[model samples]
Target: MDDEVRELNLTIDLCLRIGEVLLSSGAGAADVTATMQSVAHHLGLRRPDTDVTFTGLSMSYQRSPEEPPIVLLRQVKQRDIDYDILTRVDHLVRDVLAGRLDLFLARSQMATIVSVPRSRRRWAITLGWGVMCAAVAFFLGGNVVVAGTAFLAAAAIDRLQLLMSRRRLPTFYLQVAGGFVATLFAVGVASTDLPADPSLVVTANIIMLLAGIGFMGAIQDALTGFYVTSGARIIEAMMATAGIIAGVSGGLSVGALFGVSVGRFDPGRMLDVEGLAIVVVGSAVAAAAFAFSSYAPRRSLAPIALIASGATAIHALVIAQDIGRTWAAGLAAFFVGLVAYAVAGRVRVPPLVVAVSAIVPLLPGLSIYRGLSLLADGGSGTSMGLLAMITAASVAIALASGVILGEYVAQPLKKEARRLEDRLAGPRLVGPLRAKGRPR
Candidate 1:
């Protein structure tokens, strides 16, 4: 009985680990069942030798060779399942763990349910990204210190405001004030000129923020077959683009009162690899800090370092090649998802932790920065150099979108692996199904 208990505990542990991995890899019930059976055999646990039946989440054993099979029509607790429920559970777990989740609501809803370590790490990651944004602003030729402070401050403040909204500022006011606060850093600190022209830095900041939101929403919605949602997200993106115009127009108009002029952006200046590496370190730190802010698990961060840096390098190379990274991203994400699934067969860490982390390097941060900046700068994006910004933004969106779509396709199979694990822990009939001299 003690041995049985130990085996039972191992089985549950294995189930959880496998489930987490399969869910991230986008596996379905079959994958879960298969993964479970494999784990059980390896752990030397009692498992059904015959085929298992799965109704999405629950599972029950079929007749087998051992003793007469129990004619139990019991609902599989963790065994049988609905694909939708499983997927939802997987997503909730994955996003929340990675610090990519929108945690303000989660924290409000489940403050009692969270651990301290998880929460702190998410916060740390968020602040770290703020630093990265600062680094990126410098590369865009903003005064480095000013850009750095502005980026970090804006991110930190926004996160803090979001956390403290219980004090009751209207969202509109909040956004407006948030906009003021965030943009102030760009204008006051970065000394980035607003030119009484279009595309002032403030306008640029608002637009970029909106675009990032829209881009992420669109990708997620589209992948989930939420075409309406995707359409809405795209529309929001467009609206944000318009907002960029408005903000820049307003700032530029204000600047015009001073008879000041806007300047052209020259992309010819580049960051060397060494400098870019430093930037990546900042990006990873930012992501990790953001993760902690979101209340994600502390243990989940090391993967971010590996995945983000590698992704950044690949992204840099892709940019240098002037090749389309959209399709490339899709292909890359697909393979990553698929291979991660395979790896879960052995090691049961959810791929989402690493997959998302690894790909953070490829996010469309720069495109967002440039497009909004162009809108703020106004006039023809031509001549004074908005074209390049527009193009870079386009490419960034495509890459981000492609990565999202690819990951969507891969999440289902991952769930299947988890279902398999749950289905295996049941009674069987007659003789154990003979394997090819191997445990089934």
Candidate 2:
């Protein structure tokens, strides 16, 4: 009830709000905790103990060794990526650190940040998903008909998922439903005389579904020793993936009952100049579409596309040399992370935003679809199916680990550059002042 207590409450609120936004936007737990703690310290709270989990965040502030700490907790029940909001929050943190914003102003800014309306780009997102999936289909060697089928299938899945989201349906269920629609449509198309590779449609749609979960953040947290949060993230991703697998399997079984035989997967060539160009162009479109679907700022779109295209071009070149898929993906992801750190700062977008979106084109969707298809066949490919599953897991891990290693390589130089910039820019407005919590 006192001024000191009120101020403490407000400070805690602001810290947790920032953390929630970062976590929900797919940042690693370590980053969220460190950032929240930094904001707390800069706001005059010393040595705050912060705990961040998948479902909630907590921070405790102690006045002294003698007094009990003031503890606060905020639960995060829902999460979606909104990079527009993320950029604002990122700037807000920098402004607060520079002492350009005091408690009242900071609170006001936080309120505005939270209250800003969501973008009315649902149609754009739907169209982007369709285009992304269609482009991926072409990259994977699908013919024109297959690409069109993938576009229609992905667009339908997006609409259905959006509808289910508004109804509060669970993500696992949505994944399952999405997979069902994709498979059913692809198989149905295959049943006709389309002369196209329908399997590519399933693979393309799988990649789109996988994009909804943040596997990179999960892996980063696990590698960084945030076991609890990492475990939760991994579980969520696995459950969603499993739902897709189950749905695909179910659809195939039903198709077989109706006497429809979906064609098996055949990975097309990637060695030719035309193929390589397709890979680059498709990757750029896929990444840009993903960025749009996540509501990234328009200014950031072109940079994201460039990163994705270059990364995938590297991946294609590596694959052309007969390198293993896992190694190729890892190498390309490393390039993505390395390039992202340099370019992202120049574009005024977070590296993770571009890195994660750019990697979408390279996910092991074909491997997953192959594994599921083998499982649905019910005989003679059990070992191959197992290998495909292993490959998928390995590719996922390699993609995430490579990016982390790249960031580790980039951080030192980035920090030195930051220090140099600060030195040249001179002191900020706050001058690192330590004011009392209570109002006079």
Candidate 3:
């Protein structure tokens, strides 16, 4: 009995540790809970009750009705976007479930994954962000000069945010600072005789800042019935977005005082064939660059790029038919969801990495910025600003819901049918849908 209790304790601890990594790295609550359950069951603790929240995770197990339940809790203190760590831990979970790794080996591997310092150079990540924003410029039909300016602006934002992060600043303030720097840079460029559009530079950097917000995970959690976690995520995303608005508003105020206008953006402009091709290439480059900045595995980069390109093409083509932008975004996100699972399997990374990175190029940064700009202008523009903000929110919801729906359709039909039979089951983005030895 004593030995059994000790083993149970260790098993639950391991499960909680795994859950912590998954949750902190932006996995949905459903995925985190399912992965934890799988780990505990495979390690001989069947029927362990796992609870996942935005801030923490806990698991409990009882050997018999009369015995007191043993429980363990792990707090997720930091939320970092490290796809490499997520991919490594995901493979570890698969190996353990497949019986290729025993409890001891699995635990040891998790330890090393959590303890080892990342070898990726900070400067390289900064450079990747720069390139990503540059690609966003091209996607928005900006010229080479605009792309170069966006590159410099993004590099500056990244370095500033990095320094602020080291000082333990909150993420909201970091976003504000990033927005301010991006806008100020664009204003400076507008003041010069440069032929490039400063608006595109600001818009591109806005996209870069918005890319990190977990709209997809938030919607996934909500759809999966983890309302508490979903609400928390939504609040965080909104706060970060608000910070961007405040910072950009401040920069615009400064620009106005200096008689420099950042100009308005027309998102409704239709693209020709050559322009469409540039958008596709830009989307691919942006996705790959974002993956690299987030420390995604190199093996997964090409797959992510291809998926993003295809999705962008779909979105562009759909929008050309006079369909709403929200619908276009949803269609694109659906493609991402449909293809990401198979691509992730081939690349051996979590589908979340591919899905999130692929959707970076589709984030509604332009709408958000345009909304804020109009609101800043006030008067009749206030209504238009509110409308733009509404459109941005709608696009975000569509993107998240569309991706999850695609995952639902793409999951193996047999397993999905069984899961659907259960009233509580949700789509899996980061774990095996069924436990080992469970009937298919």
Candidate 4:
């Protein structure tokens, strides 16, 4: 009984974590709502028969087996506010009413989080994938160093581009602005006669970095069984991905006007070990860049970054050896699942946040770009695009599934703890000690 209550509480915490991750990841309200619904469903919080509909920013829930049920409107920027508060109230009420005061005090306790301003301990706390990419590029291959450096510089340019974009600028205008800056930066490097291969690598990586911008939200929506919401998420993801293609295509075309032709990519070059490793590092870097782009709490990046670096190394190793991306993805997803679960359990944090953060490196942003560009240019391998699509889907699915799996692993232990508490709490007291009304 006590364990069940704690799990409910865990669900609430997970909800807020989902919101923060989404917000920091640049997710829209639809993403946030879908994530909250998924968290709620996983915890079994909603009534089995309830009809719950989520708008991107708010929600309408109707609890009923009724022919007609009343709508309960909740319009909050964050989704899980009431759920968390009520979980606390639920535990307290249940304990007092059921004569189970001892339940909460047992081993496996819950704690509240205080969101205080902390120092920016970037390395100590913010171990994200970007730095991992830097290390891989720095150590494994000289060409990669340039690619990593250019990508970082391009990301900086993209951030500045957002300032011009904030006034509700035309989508093309904003994208072109960002892409142009990135392209120009690479062009300047090209003026020094930088090698075509590394320059192309960096340019291509930048282009792919922008794919699946709202994957977490979209996948969360789908998992929560909100097909409509998930479809919207998919469309949004597609639009962003298309924008990436346009930005890259436009920038490449414009750069060639100044004699900086974005070099033609050669698929044969990617078969080498260094190439494969850099790809994995690039994956981790994408995740880091996403969080950095979103202005997440500066302190919480190190461990995540470290995890990314390690995950990428494994991913790269497998792929370079002609092993499938799926095996590597599963390996990466398992560590991610464990970290997300353990951290959430220990610190009252949310698994969704960690899941989103960790999986950024694994998204198939590059594959999507290469696939689409190939199609546009009348190249073969139509299946490459499909592979990229599946790669992105599989990674998200792996992440969500892994986290859910970890939670299932956690439930029974919590349940046992709760049962022990209930046993210790003894039976309920009868009125007047049962024998003689109040005279006993």
Candidate 5:
């Protein structure tokens, strides 16, 4: 009886740990809950009840009606984007589900995955962020000088945010600081005689800041019926974005005082066929660089670049046909969702890694900046500013929903079609869709 009780406790602990990692790494509540249940089921815990919130995870199991339930809860304190850790943990879960790894060995592997330091140095990751911003500048039709300025501004923002994070400052404040730095850099550049567009630089940095928030994950949770967790994620993403807005607004006010501006927003700008090749290359580089900055597995970079390039081409082609930007973005994101699973399997990483990274280049940064700039100028342009902001929100929602719909379509094509075909079951982005072996 004592031995059985001990085993039960160990199994619950393992499940909670797995849940914590998935939740912290930006997996949707449905994915986390499904993964935890699969782990518990494989470890001989029949019918364990699992609950996932934005900040905590809990699991409970009972041997029989005659005995009490063993419940365990784990709090997720850190929310960082380390796709390498996510990939390693994902592999560990698969091995356990396959019956190749026993309970104790799986626990050991999980511990190492969470405890080990990242392979890339902090400086390398910061450099990757700089490269990503530079690529975004080029994608926005900026010249080499503009790209260089964006690169410098992004590196400085990363370093400043790092320092603030080390001091244990809140993420919202860090975002504000990053926005301020990016805008200040743009302002200084505008005051120079250089022939670069300061607006492009600020827009690029805005995308960089927006990329880290989990807008996709938030929408996924909502679609999967995790309303509480979805609401929490939505609030968090809004708060972070609001921080960026506040900082950029402050900087724009300062720039106004200094007689320097990022110029007026142009809503009519569209991608032309002449520069399509350059934009495609820029998009690919931006996606891969973002993955690198987030510490994605080295093996996943090429595939991510390829996927992002394809998505960019699709978006450009659609936009060239005079389709709405929101529709174009949704179609591109749908392609990302459709292909991410097959690509992730080949590269041995979670599909979420590929999907999220590939979609980064398409975020509505320009619209966001345009709206803020107009609002700041605030006379007759207030209505236009609000319209731009609404457009930005629509694009964001379309991107998230499009990716999820793609997942819904793609998952049923895999071997787990039977389980995934159930109306109540959501697509699996981070865990096995079907358990491997029967309970012991």
Candidate 6:
């Protein structure tokens, strides 16, 4: 009985650790719970129940009908999206399910997986963030001067965010600080006689800020009936956005005091395509750079870049036909999800990682920034500001839901394939192959 209890505890511990890593790395709640249950069952535990949410996970296991159940819970406090970690845990689960990894070895590997040491060099990460923001400016039709300003401002913001994080500042304040950092740069540049579009700098940096939030995950949770977790994530996104608004507003106020004028942006030229080839190519580079910011593996960058460029091309094509921006974005993101599913297999990465990274270029950062800019200017166009905000929200939900629908269409067969791999006794591609003449 003592040995059995110890084994049960170890199994539960492994499941909870895996669940924590998956959830933190932005895996959907359903996937986390299902994966945990599958792992527990494959490890010889009977009738495991797993509950997943935005913040934490709880799992229980029973050995026999007459025996009392062992319940275990883990509260996940830190949530940073690291696709590399998610992929590792995902592969580990498959290996365990294939009976290649035993319980004892699994526990040790789980510890290493959860450690999550950053593999990419620090300078590389900073360069990635800077280039990504600059590439976004180029994609948005900014000139050389505007892209340069965006690159510098984004680099500074990334460094500031790192410092704030080291000081253990709240994320809300960090968002505010980041917004202020970018706006301050924009206003300072505008105050000078530099021949640059300062507005483009703000727009690019805003997109970077918006890109880091899990708008897609939030909408996915809501649509899938995980209301509580969805609500939490929605509120968090909103607050982070609000922080950016507040910070930008404050910076603009200071600029007004210094006699600097931040003019309203003209929306007519936002999607112009006179030089669209540059935009499309830059979108690919920007998407890959953003993925690196989240610690995605180097091998996955090429596929992610291709997927993002395709989505951008579709979005630009649809918008050229006079389709609504919201609808165009949705269509493009749906295609991204669908293509990611097929390409992920070839690239040996999960579809969600590719889809999320690919869709980064299409997020409604410009719309959100435009709305906030309007509101900061004495609230004269309040109705129009509200409309822009609504449009931004619509685009966000559309992007997320489109991806979810595409995954839903692609996943049934994939799940069946995984199950078949689990049941097979022969050598398989994903796990360690059976030794020749050793078993069966």
Q: What is each predicted model's overall lDDT from 0 to 1?
A: 0.41, 0.81, 0.88, 0.45, 0.88, 0.77
Kindly list the per-residue Cα lDDT of model 5 for residues 230-348, writing each as its tens digit.
99999999999999988888888889999998775464453886788888999999999999999999899999999999998898889889898899999999999999988998899
Q: Candidate 5, after superposition: displacement of residue 303 in Å?
A: 1.0
- Tens-digit per-residue lDDT, 1-440, candidate 6: 69979988998899899878876766556556556767777777755776778888888876678988889889987755677777787788878988889999998887887675767777778888889999988888778888888999888998898898888888899899988888898898889887877877887888888887878667766765677877888898899888887888787788889988666666556567776687689899999999898888888899999889988888888888898889998999888877777787777766778888899888887787788777766456777888888998899888988887766555444654443322212112122221121112
lDDT of 2 by residue, 1-440 (tens): 89998999899999899888888888888777767766887888976888999999999888888988899999976766788787778778878988899878988998898897877467887898999999898888788898899999999999998899899999999999999999998889978987887788899999999887878878888877788999999999899989888877777777888888776787545445567888788889889988888888788889999988888888878877888889989999998877777777677777777788889999988889888887666688877888898899899888988887776666446654344222211111111112122112
Q: What C-alpha lDDT does candidate 1 achieve relative to the native structure?
A: 0.41
TM for every model, in the order presented, reads: 0.53, 0.92, 0.96, 0.59, 0.97, 0.91
Cand. 4 Cα-lDDT: 0.45
In terms of lDDT, the poorest run of 10 residues in model 5 is 416-425
Which pairs clash (backbone N, Cα, C closer than 3 Å) in model 2?
A: none
Candidate scoring better on lDDT of 2 and 6: 2
**C-alpha displacement of 259 in model 5, angstroms?**
1.2
lDDT of 1 at 278: 59
Top-TM-score structure, candidate number: 5
User: What's the distance in Å from true for residue 143, model 4?
Assistant: 3.6
Clashes of each: 71, 0, 0, 13, 0, 0
lDDT of 3 by residue, 353-389 (tens): 9999999999998998899889888999999999999
Which parts of model 4 are misplaced by more than 4 Å? 1-152, 169-180, 187-192, 196-212, 256-259, 264-300, 372-440
lDDT of 1 by residue, 1-440 (tens): 47654445434443444344342223333334444454444344346342322212322233246634332222332211122233233444344344454333323323333221322343554565465445444433455454555466557555755664556653334444545455444444334443221112342234224422335435544543445535644664555454444444454444446554333333323334546665456445544433333333445555545444555555445545655545444444444444433342233244433444344434443444445456555688533336545554565466445444444454335554333222222110001111111244
Write down the worst ten-residue block by lDDT for model 3. Answer: 414-423
Off by over 4 Å in 5: 265-270, 416-423, 435-440
